[model samples]
Target chain A: MGLNIKPLADRVLVEPAAAETTTASGIIIPDTAKEKPQKGTVVAIGTGKKDEPLTVQVGDTVLYGKYSGSELKLEGNDYLIMRESDILAII
Target chain B: MGLNIKPLADRVLVEPAAAETTTASGIIIPDTAKEKPQKGTVVAIGTGKKDEPLTVQVGDTVLYGKYSGSELKLEGNDYLIMRESDILAII
Candidate 1:
């Protein structure tokens, strides 16, 4: 990846997983039933605020709320920037 | 307030304002259109995380996301418990 933007203040940049087009049973899912992927790979992390340290690291898979984060496009790729607290768990 | 619960680690207890039932021009808003109140008064605060201190104090008015925090009822009054970071601003 050639992206060069850095997150600030406990924020993280994530590359969302590709939306699932098929169910586990091999059934094709309609676009209208496709939910936004809630899992993503951490691409960049902030240095964290004073007295706080970030727990997630680059390349770590994380889970977050469907509506969390602000969306931006970089290098023709979509990414989300959100506070660390918005992340629900590290997977 | 006779509530005795103490929030743990950066969490705060807030007393939400009553939902607005009327518009500024005295027009009545339907229940379906009554958005959850995002403003509230701080009733109790936690000691904050290690090396971080709570910025809002008791009696302070605060703003938060519409869907932030967990809801609970105590003493027949509704309250919200959320992390200090969930608070968007102190008013």
Candidate 2:
């Protein structure tokens, strides 16, 4: 958790929720049809802009646009760099 | 514009900025290589969640993720339905 990634200026580092591989009816989801999870846990946060103080916290789970944020790697772990506004709801 | 569409629950309707058809040097850019504009004017907004009253108002020019919102055609004009958080900065 001590990776060097530090979100800056309304950006956030999110650990995306695990993708679902099976449906409620137990039908396995095909790899090509699987979509990236829209939910994630905030691992790091930025100070935010002067006028807009960020509302999301480091431990909060959030919902976001399905394809929002840029993907990157830090310390061998995958993460997404998202603008604070990309997060839809705090869960 | 009196479009019949109304955004619901933290969603905002945005009219994207005009795409740059040419670069600074005036090199004509072709349609095939164009990218969607990241800035837009907020035409409409949702009521927002109980705790998160919306901040951006109609006519506010805002920045958002390039692919963050869903596109829909309303009244012969194109608009994107975006979650409030998908907006990054008010310009």
The weakest ten consecutive residues by lDDT in model 2 chain B span: B23-32
Model 2 spans > 4 angstroms off: A21-37, B1-91
lDDT of 2 by residue, B14-91 (tens): 987677766454534344555533777898887676589899999998878766776544444556778888898896
What TM-score does each of the candidates earn?
A: 0.45, 0.46
The TM-score measured for candidate 2 stands at 0.46
Worst 10 residues of 1 chain B by lDDT: B25-34
DockQ of each: 0.02, 0.03
Query: Residue B54 of model 1: what lDDT?
Result: 79
Candidate 2 per-residue lDDT, tens place, A1-91, comes to: 5667678898999998767554332322233332322667899999988876677888886656678899997887788999976775454
Off by over 4 Å in 1: A1-91, B21-37
> What are the RMSDs of all candidates, in order?
11.1, 11.8
